[model samples]
Target: MAEETADDYLKVIVFQLKEEEYAMEVDYIQSIERMQPITRIPGVESFIVGVMNLRGVITPVIDLRKRFNIESMEYNEATRILVLNKDNSEIGFIVDGANDVMDIPASKIEPTPEVVGGVAEEYLRGVVKLEDRLFTLLHIDKVLNKNNEEKRTVV
Candidate 1:
């Protein structure tokens, strides 16, 4: 086997939530789109706003702020839907906006620090130290995992 380079491990798509910048792996991102009409589901969790018809397929819409326990903000022109695929399930995350795609070398990435609060530590894949700032890379699997577990326990 050959040694892995910094390019071999990390891939990211940056976006905004509550005006703060964040990113997740490009592999987990299915699509991004403008906000659309969503059908609210009664009795669902607060984070789960509702579902949307995406070219005839229904996809659940989640308020990323609520999911991460961040303060909610009103949607603006920059608002977008980040569709994520996890464990064969599709979930659409509503974010403040979408930013550019960044390829951070694995060497530049560090384990998520314990200082970041509200956003669960398990939800973070790592932190990428850029030229002047740090970008938190979210672990979609762990974030979605918690939601799936909640659903199972409720049933």
Candidate 2:
């Protein structure tokens, strides 16, 4: 066993999902964009909302609520799409609304519990406790890699 160092402090972009707080590593995020018109594509997973032209790039967007089997809600003014880079492929995840960036030290993040919220436990890195708030840390790779392939994809 080794002592956690300064590198253990995880910088995360926190957001709201079904009224609960969730977070993902800032390193994997590209940018947070406002909800934009998504061109629907048929024959894909239900969670796959559609693709959008981000600047000159075509990016696929997924509704995190639908992906996690959480109750769907109307996209409001605060709704946002989190741009993510994995390997060379870029994707987007629509969340309830993005909040703030917070750094949670390793000791503050607890291991995934049997049932955290709507998302499957396996897709979670852990949960963070800060004062009266709790933010579930999302494992972006696991959430996007449906096949669980070992191949590393760099964004």
Model 1 collision count: 0
Per-residue lDDT tens digits for candidate 1, residues 1-155, read 77778667677889987656788888888899899999999998888999999878799999989888899988888899999877777889999899978787787788988888667787887888889867788877777665543333554
lDDT per residue (tens digit) for residues 1-155 in model 2: 88778798998999999879999999989999999999999999888999999999999999999888898999999999999999988899999999999888878999898866568886898999999999999988788866642347899
Q: How many residue pairs clash in each candidate at the backbone level?
A: 0, 4
For model 2, the superposed segments whose C-alpha errors exceed 4 Å read 1-5, 148-155
- TM-score of each candidate? 0.86, 0.89
* lDDT (C-alpha) at residue 105 in model 1: 78
Q: Write out the backbone clash pairs for model 2.
A: 87-153, 87-154, 87-155, 88-154
Every model: Cα RMSD to truth: 4.1, 6.2
